[model samples]
Target chain A: MQTPSATLVSRFAMEVASACFVMAIGALVCFGAREFGIGWGDAGPQPGYFPFYVGLIIVIASCGVLVQALLQRRDRRESFLTREQGGRILAFFGPMLGFVVLSVLLGMYVALTIYLCSVMVVQGGYRFHKAAAISVATAVISYVVFEVWFLVPLLKGPLEAWLGVH
Target chain B: MENFGNLMDGFGIALSFYHLALMAAGVLLGILVGVLPGLGAPNGVSLLLPLTFTMDPVSAIILLTSMYWGALFGGSTTSILFNIPGEPSSVATTFDGYPMAQQGKATQALTLAFMSAGTGALFGVVLITALSTWVAQFALKFSSPEYFAVYLLTFASFIGMGSASPFKAVVSMMLGFACAAVGMDGVSGNVRLTFGFTALISGISFLVAVIGLFGIGELLQTMEEGLRFEGLHARINIRDVFHAIYTLPKYWVTLLRSALIGCWMGITPGGPTAASFMSYGLAKRFARNKENFGKGDPNGVIAPETADHSAGTCAILPMLALGVPGSATAAVMMGGLMIWGLTPGPMLFIERPDFVWSLIASMYLGNVMAVVLVLATVPFFAAILRIPFSIIGPMIVVVCFIGAYTIAGSTLDLWLVLPFGILGYVFKKLDYPIAPMVLAMVLGDKAEDAFRQSMIFSKGSLGIFWTNSMLVASIMTIAMLLLFWPLIGKLIGRLRRAI
Candidate 1:
C-alpha cells in the first residue's frame, strides 16, 4: 500500500523547531546588544540595556514554550502537516518565490504579468488566452493607477527601457 | 460645551465637497478589501497609506478612517453570507449570521448587523467627543514616568486579556522589541541589533512588517486552507430592508451592553477581535433563548457587530489622546501620523486643532456614510467573492509586494516581506498573538525613550517607577495588577472552589 497520505511532520517537532528558532534569534540579539554595553552608564541606560533584557526575556519565554511542548505527550501525535497539505503549501509557495525572484530580475510589471498568468493558467486550469488577458489587464490598470495618477514609480527592467516607458 | 463648539468648527472644515468625495472613495475601497478574506482593516489602511502621503493630514486621515469604518461594516457581510470572517473582528458574527442566512433571513440579519454596528460606532464617537478633550488635557500633565506607566499598562493588559499562551505572547512581544531596537539608537548614537546588514541601517519598517504579516502572510494561510468561496447570493429587497430597520430597537439592551463592552476593550487595548468575542459570549450567556444563539438568533448577529464597530471606532481615541495606539490599525495610522510630521499625543489637540477636530467630525459623517453606502453595495461586494481564488489570490500577492516596495522604494523591503510572511504564517499557526508584536514594534522606541528618560530623572534608580508621584504609583499598581491578572484569576478560582 502506498503511504502517500502519511504525516509529513509532527506538531511536536515543528513546535520544537520554532522554539529553537526563536531562541537563536534571542541569542543573536543578546550577542549584538553586548557590542554596545548592556549596562547602565553614568548618565542612564546604555543603548543596549533595553534590548539586552528584551532578548533575555525572549530566551526565557521560548524556553518555557520548549519545555511545555516537550512535556505535552498528547500534542506529539498530532500532525503539523500531512503529505497532501505539504504539497498544497509548496504548490502555492513555489510560485510566490518565483514571483519575488522574477520581480527582482525583470521589472515588477513584467513579473506581474508572468506571475499572474502562470498561477491562473497552471493552478487554476484556465484557458491560456483568458489568463493572458486578465494578467495584461491587471498590469495596465496598475500602471494607470500607480504611475499615471498617483505618480509613484515602481521598479522597471530592460523591457520598460526598450519600450521607452520610463 | 467648548468641545461642542470645536466639533462644530470641525464640521465646517469637513463639509467640503472634496472631503466628501474622498470619504466615498475610501469607503468603497474599504468594502472591497474588507469583503475579501486575508485583506482586513489593518492591511487595507496600510495599503492605502502610501496614496495619502501627498494629501494634507486632515484629508489623509479622513480617507483612512472612512475606509476603516467601511471595512468594519464589510467584514460582517462576509460572515453572514459565507460563514467566513473577512476580518478577525467579525469571526463572532459567523456564529449566528451564517445560520440566519441559511434560514433565509439574510436580509434581517444583515440589517440588524449594520444597524447595531452603526449605533455602536456612533456611541463610540460620542464617547470620544465627550472624553477626548478631558483625556488630552490630563495627558498634557504627564511626564516621562507617567508616559512609561501608560505604555506599561497597555502591554500588561495585552498579556492579561490575550488568549494566547503567556510565554508565547512574551516571545512575540520581545521579538518585536528586538526588531524595533535594530538600525540605530537615537539616544546613544550606536546602532544595535542590525546584525551587520547595510540594508537594515534604516531600521525595520513597521509598514513592511504589516504588509508582510497581515497581507502576504494571511494570503499564504488562505492558500494552505485551499479556500473556495461559495457565497449565498441574496438580492436584498428594499421593503425587507426597511422592515428589518424598523425592528432594530427590539434589541436595545444588546446594543447598549455591547457598546459598553466595545468601548472598554477599545480603551484598554483588548482590541476589536477580543471585544467582539467577549460581547458574543456575554450575549449568549444572557440571552433568553440561548439555544438559538448558534442557530441564527438576531441578537447573536447584533451583539458582536455592535461591539466590533464600537471598539474599532473608540480605539482611535487612545491613539489621538495618548499616542498609545489601541489597535493594530491605529498603530499603523499612528505611524502615518509621524510620517506626516504630526506627533500623536495631547500636544496635537492644542497644536493642530484643525487636524484633530476635522478627523473627529469626519467620524460622524463617515459612519453615517458607511451605513448608507454599505447597505447599497452589499450585492456588489458579494459578486466580488465569486471571483476565483486563483485569480484573486495572486492579485493580492502582487498588491502586497507593490505596497511594500512603495513604502521606501527600496527593493530590500520587497525581500523582507518574504521571511516576514513565513514568520507570520508560522506564528499564526502556533497560536501567537501578532497584535502585541506589531504594537511593540511601533511603540518600542518611544517606550524605550520614556523608560530611559525616567531612569535619568531618577538617576538610574528602579524605584522611581512607583515612588515618583501618586499618579505614577497608582498607574504602576494597576499595570502590575493587570500583569498578574491570570494568576489572580486562578487564585480567585481556587478560593471559590474551596468555598
Candidate 2:
C-alpha cells in the first residue's frame, strides 16, 4: 500500500488547513494592528482601530469554523478532491504557476506564446505546429489591441527592446 | 416629469450614431459572454474595462451597460435549446423551456422567452424613470455616518441572504477588506499593509482582482471539467417572430407579475437568479391552470425570463442612486464608475446629469438592441458553443492574462492573477460566496474612509452612529436582524425538516 502522503487530501483536512491558515492571517493582522496603534488618537480613531476589530473577528470566526470542522466525523465530510482529480488540477495549475515566473524572465509576449502553446500541446495533446500558430496569433493580436490601438504599454524584455519597439 | 425630460434628452445622446454602434457591438459581445460557459458579465465587463478607459464616459457606460443587457438576453437562449443554463438566472428556464423545445414548440418558446424578457426590461426602465430621481434626491441627504450605515446595510444583507455559511461570508468579506487595506493609507499617507513592497504603492487594482478571480479563476475551473458543448439546433423565421410577438398578449398577467417580482427583488438585494426563481414559483402558485405548468407551458418560460431580465436591468438603480450594488454585475459597474473618476450616488445625478440620463436612456436602447440582435444571432452563438474547451480554454486564459496585464500595465498584476485564480477556484469548490469578497474589496477602503471621517467629526465617539436618528434606526434594524440571522437559519432548517 502507498503511504499516507500519497492519499488524497480530504475535505476535513482542507477545511482544517484553511482554518489554520486564516487564523495565522488573523494573528498577523492583529500584530500589525498593534504596531499601527489600535486605540483612538487625539485626532480620531487610530489607523489600526478598524483593522484590529476586523482581525479580531477573523480570529474568532476562524476558531469557530475550525472547531466545527474538527468535530465533524471523517466519513461525514465530502471529499475535497480525490487523488486523480487532484492530479488533473495540478497538471494545469503547476504549469500556469511556472508561466508567471517564465513571463517575468522572457518578457510577457514571448512568455504568452510559450505558455499557450505548452498548455494546448502538453495538456490537451495537440500537435506542436497548431499550438505554436495559435499562440503566436494570440500574442500578436494582443499586441495590436493593447499596444497599438489602446496605446497601453505592457511589460517588455530584451527581445522586445532588441527589436527597437518601445 | 423632470426625470422624463432628462431621459428624453438622454435619448438624444444615446441615439447618436457612435453610441448606437457601440451598443450593438457591446450587446453582441455580451451575448457571446453569456452564451459561453465559464464567462459572465463580471469577467466580460472586467476584460473590456481597460478598453473602455479610452472612450468618453457616455460612450463607455453605454457600451458596458449594453453588454450587460445583452448578457441577460443571451442567458435564456441556451436554456431553451439545450437544458444548459448559460447564466445562473436562466436555470429556471430549462424546466419549461427544454420541455417546450422537446414538444417541438421551440420557436414559440424562444419567442415567448425573448418577448417576455424585453417586456420585463422595458417595464423596469419605466419604473426607473418614475422612481430613481426621488431615490437619488433622498440619497443626497446622506452624510458620512449615513454612508457608513448604508455600507453596513449592504454588507449585512450579503451575510444574511448568502447561501454560504454566514461566518464564511464574513471571512471572505474580511479577507477582501484586508486586501483593500494594502497599499497606501489615504489618511496618514502611510502604507500599512504593503509589508515593505514598493510595487504596492498604489492600492490593489480592482480591475486585476476581477479579471483574476472571475476570468482566470473561472477558466481554471472550466479546464478541470474539460467542458464540451452539445448545442441544440434552433431556427426561426420572420413568421415565427411575428407569431411569438402575437402570442405575447396572452401572457400579460404573467409578464406584469414577473416584472413586479423582478423590480422588487432588484430594488432589494435578491439579484436576478433569486428573482427568476421567485417569479417562477409565484407564477406556478398563482397560475389559473397550475396543472398545465412545467409541461411545455409558455407562461412558464415567460415568468422566469421576464423576471431575470427585469431584475438584471433594475439592479443598476441601486448602484446609480444609492452607491450600493444590488448584484455582482452592478458592483463591477460601480467599480467602472469609480475608475472613471465619477463616484456613483445621488451626487452623480446632480454633478453629471448628462452621464446619468444617457445611461438610463441607453438601458432602453440596449434592451431593444439585445432582443433584436439575440433573436437574429442565435445560430451564430450556438456555433461558437461547439468549439471544444481544449482550444477555447487556453485562449480564454490568454485573454484573462492580457486583461490582467492591462491593469496598470504591470507584470506584477499578472503574477497575482494566477494565485487569485486558484483562490477563486478553491472558494468556488468550497462553496464560498465570492460576490461579498468582491463588493467588500470595492467598498472596504471607501467604507473605512467614511468611518474615519465620521469618527473625526464625532471626536472619536462611537455614539454618533447611534445618536443620529436615521443612522440609529437603520443600523439598529440591520444589527438586530443580523444578530438573529442564525436563529432565522435554524428556524428555516427546522421548518424544512418539518415539511
Candidate 3:
C-alpha cells in the first residue's frame, strides 16, 4: 500500500517526466527544422525560426520544473493520478484511441460505424440491433451532411483506396 | 451622438434573420456546453470555430460572442440547482446557490441568478458601447514595449494575486510562455525547438492545449473518482420568477458593486472567476446581514452571479478594443473574429464599425433572450440532470473528440486533446490553478512577438521599456508590486494576528 505522501512524490515525478518528454519532442522538431535550411532570416525571420526558440524555452523551463519537483518535500506533494482513477480515464479514451487507429485502417465511415456501435453496445449497454442501427444512421447522416452537402472532404482510409474509391 | 448612430448602424446588421439565428444557436450551444461539467466556454467556442469557416466573418463573430455570453449564464444554472459549477467562475455561486436549492428555493435561486446575470450583462454591454472608442484610442498609444509591460503585468497579477502559491503560479506561467515559444522564432524566423516532426511546423494549437488541459484532464479525473450523483431535483414556477425580480431591489448595492467589479476585471485579465470571488468577498464584507451570507442568502447569490455575467459580457471589450482576450471564452471569440478575417484591435472599430457595434447591440438582445429562454426552460434543463452520468459521460467524450477534430480537421489535434485532458485532470487533482496556464498560453505568442519587436526597435536596449513614460511607469509599478507581494502578504498576516 502506497502512502499518500509517497504517491504524491511519484505523481510529481510523473509530471516531471511528462514535461521532459514534451521538451525532448520539441527539441527534436527544432533540430529537424534547422536541417531544412529554416534558420533565422536577414529580412526578419523564417517560419521555423520562432518555433526553435520556443522549443528551447520549453526544454529550459521543463528542466526547472523537473528540478523543483525533485527538490520539493514529500509531505508537501500531492498525487494527481492513481490506479483507482484510471478507469474513467481509460473507459472514454480507450474507445477514442481505438476509433483513431480504426479510422486509419477502415476509413472514416466504417471506422465511425464500428466505433459508435461498440461504444453504444459495450459501454452504453444498448442492444446489438439498437447500437448498430444508431451507428449506421449517424454515420450515413454525417456523411451526407459533411461530405455531400458541406463538401468537406472526409479522409478515406487505406481500405477505401484498395477499392478504387480515392 | 456618433456612438448612438454607430450603434444604430450596428443594429441594422445585427437584427437580420441570419445574425439572429446565429446568436440563438450560439447561445443555446453555449448554455449546453456551460451546463456540462468539464466543458467550458473556451472549449465550446474553439470546438465550434471550424463550423464558422463557411460563414461570413460578421455572422461568425456574433455567433461566437453570443455563445460566450450564453455559457456564462448557463454556468450559473448548474451551480444553483445541482451544486455543480460548470466553470470555475460559477464556483462562488455554489456557496449560496446550493443552500437556496436545499431550502426549497431552487426556482427562486435560478431565476435570481438568471436575472442578475442578464442585468450584469446589460451593464457590461453598455460599458463596451460607451468606452470602446476611448479605450481603443488609448490603446493606440501602446507600442511594443507598453504591450509587453501590459502582458507581463497581466500575467503577474493573474498568478501572484489569483493563485494559492505565487511561486508555483509564476513557474506555471513561465512554463506556458515556454510552450507558446515552441514552434517558431517570430522575430528572427529561426526554428527554435521543433525536434523534427512535421506537426511541429504549425506549432501547438493553444485551443488544443486548453481543451486537453481542462476538458480531457477533467474527464480523466471524473473517470478515476467514478461519477457520484447527489440526487437533486427542483421545480421552477412562474411565481418564483416574479419573486426573483421582486427580491432584486433589496440587493441593489451588491448588484452595482459586483457589476463594476466584473467590468473592470473583465477588461483586464482578472476574468470571471476572480470577479466572482472578489464580488462575493466584498459583498460579505459590506452586507448588513453578513451572518446570512453562506446560509442561502439571496445577496450571496446576487453578488457572484452578477459579477460572473458582467465579467463574461465585458470581456468582449478587451478582445474587440485591443485584440487582447481577458479570459478563455474571450480567446475563443477572438479566434472567431480572426476566422471571420476581421482582426480584433483598435483598427476593428475604425474599419469594422458595423461588426463592432452590432456585436455590442446583440449583447443587449442576447441577454434578454437568455433571461426569457432560461426562465422558461429551467425545468427542461433541470430534467437533463436526471440522466445518468454513464450516458452523459461517454457522450461528452464523443463531443470532445468531435470538437477537437473540427478545429484543425487533423487526427493529430484529436490525439492532442486527450493528453491535455489528462493534464487538466492532474492540475485539478493537484489543486494547481489551470486558469493561469490557459491565460498564459493565449498571451504567450503576443508576449513573445511584443518582446522581440520591442528588442528590434530599441536596438537590444532593454532601457527602451522606460523610454515611453507610460510604459516605464506601468512596468515599474508592476515590478515593484510583484517584488513586494510576499512582504505585503506577511504584513497582512501579522495584522490579522494582531487584530
Candidate 4:
C-alpha cells in the first residue's frame, strides 16, 4: 500500500531488536566467562571474574533498554529507516562486500581496479572508458604508495605471482 | 620554573627542520581527511599510525597531534561553508556559521572562528604547561586503588554527562569490556572468551573496530542520507581578516568563558563535542541578544569554535598525565603510544621527559601553524569538496580496508570490519555512544587489572575503595556521586515541590 520510500521498520522494533541482540551477546559472554571460572581465587579474582560482571551488567542494561522501548511503544512510532534508505545502504554495502571477496581472490590492486570501475559505471553513471582510466590510475597509485614506498606487503593472488611482482 | 626550563629544552628538541616539515605535512593531510566525509581525526590518525611505526616516538606524536589540530580547524570550515559538520565537534559551529555565510559574511565568520580557536588552543597549551608537573606529581603517589577509581570515574562521567540514555551508555561500555576480555588474560595466563577460535586469541583490535565504526560506518550513513555538498563559495579577503582580528578583542568575555568550559570538559572527559555544545548553550543563555544566536551572530560562531579547539587541546593533557584519554581521538593516540612501547602514565613524565616535553612544545607550535595553514588552504579544501562523492566514496572505502589490512596483515581483521561496521551504524542510529565503548576497549584490561590488584590488596573487600587513602576515597565518592547525580537531581526536585 506504500511506496518503496515508505517506512520499512519502526524505531521501536529496531530498538527492541538491538536490545535483544545485545542481551544475547551478553548471555554468550557470561557463558564463555564461566568456562574460566568466574570466582575469586588465592591470587585474587580469576580471569573471567571481571568479564562475568561486565557481561552481567550488559544484560541488565539491555533489559532496561528493552523495557523502556516496550513501555514507549505506543507513542514511539518513528521510522528507523525508509525502504529507499535501505536500498541505498545495500547498494553501497554490496560493492564493499564484493571488493573484499575479490581482494582475497585477485589481490587488492586488481580488486581495487575492478571494484572502482564497476561501481563507477554501474552506480555513478560514468562512461566505461573514464571509469577504467580512473580506476587503473588509482590502483597504480595505491600500488606505489603501499608496496613500493611503504614496503608493506598486501594480500596477493595468483595474478601477481604470474606477473613476477611480489 | 623547573617546568619552564624543561619546556625551553622541549622547544629546542621540537624546533628541528625535520620535525617542522613533518608538522606541515601532517597538518595538510589532516585537513584533507577532516574536510572529507567518512574520514575523521580518529580514523585518520589510525591510518597514519602504521606509517609512524618506523619513526621515533616524539616525532610520531608530533605528527599525529599536529594532524589533530589541523582536523579540528578543518571541521569548522565545512560547518561555515556547507552547513555540514566535517567533525562531530564542529556540529555546533554550523548553527550560526552557515547562516552567517548565507548572509554573505563568510569571510568574517571564518576569521572569527579561526581566531577564537587559536586563542582557545593557546590557553589550553598554557594550562598544560603550568599544570602538567603538578598533576604528574600528584598522580605519582596513586596506587592501584586510586588508578581504579580514576578509571571508574572516567566511565561514570560518560553516563552522568552524556546526552545519550544512561542505560544505553552502560550497554555500549560493557560491550567494549566484553570485547576487551576476549583475549588471553595477562594476569592469569589464561585465554579467555575466544570460543576456541585462533583468530580471536590475540583479541579484537581496537584499530579494526575504529576503522569499521568511524570509517566504513560513516560512509554507510552518508550513503543513506544521500549527502550533497552544496556550499557557498568562500574566499578570504585580507581586509576582512584584519577587520575580524581587530574586532576579536570585543569578544574577550565569550572567549575566556568558553576556554574555561573547554578546559573543564576536556580534563574531565566530556570531550570536544560536548564542550562545544555546552559552551554554545551557556553563551546563548547568558547573551543579551540571545535571539541573534543561530542567525548570523558572531558570538555563536566564536563560542563553539573556541570551546572545541580548547577542549581538543586540553584533552591531550589527561592522556599524558593519567593514561586516560579525554576523547575518542585521544584514545586512538594512546593506543598508538602502547604500540610504540611507551606507557602513558605519570611515570612517562619522569622516564620520558624529553618525549613528553617535546610533545607539549609541539602542541604550541602546531596550533600556530594550523591557524596560519588553515587560513591559506581554505579555498583549496573547498575545491576538494566539489569532487563528486561517487569517486571519493569508494576511494575512501579502499583506503579504510587497506588501513585495516596494514594494522596486522590479517585477512581475518578485514573480515571483522564488516560486522563492526554494521554494529557501528546501528548503534549510532540508536544513540548508543561509541566513544565510551572505544575508551573501554582501550583501557578495559588496565582498569580490570587495577581493580583486581586493589581487590587482592584488600582481600576482595570493597571497603578499601572507601576506606583507603583520602585520595582514593574522594575519587570513589566523586565517581559515585556523578553516577547517581541524575537520580539525586530528580529526588531534590520532588522534595522542593513538596515543600
DockQ of each two-chain model = 0.81, 0.52, 0.29, 0.83
User: Tens digit of lDDT per residue, candidate 1, span B369-433?
Assistant: 99999999999899988989888988999999899888888999889998998888888888889
lDDT, ranked from best to worst: 4, 1, 2, 3
**Given candidate 4, what's the lDDT at residue B328?**
94
Please, what are the lDDT tens digits per residue for candidate 4 over residues A1-166? 4355789888998999999999999999999999989998888898889999999999999999999889988988799999889998999999999999999888888998999999999999999999999999998898888889878878888888999999
DockQ of predicted model 3: 0.29
Model 3 ranges off by over 4 Å: A1-79, A148-151, A158-166, B182-192, B483-499
lDDT of each: 0.92, 0.83, 0.75, 0.93
**lDDT (Cα, tens digit) per residue for candidate 3, span B174-266:** 556656666665654554455556776667777788777767776666566666546367677788789778978887898999999999898
lDDT-better candidate, 1 vs 4: 4
Best by DockQ: 4
Please estimate how well model 2 matches the true structure, expressed as its whole-model Cα lDDT.
0.83
**Considering summed lDDT, which 10 consecutive residues are worst modelled in model 4 chain B?**
B481-490
DockQ value for model 1: 0.81
lDDT at position B386, candidate 1: 92
TM-score winner, 2 or 4: 4
> In angstroms, how far off is B434's CA in candidate 3?
3.1
Model 4 Cα displacement at B39 (Å)?
0.9
Compute the interface RMSD for candidate 3. Answer: 4.2
Q: Please tell me the interface RMSD, in Å, for model 4.
A: 0.8
Candidate with the larger lDDT of 1 and 3: 1
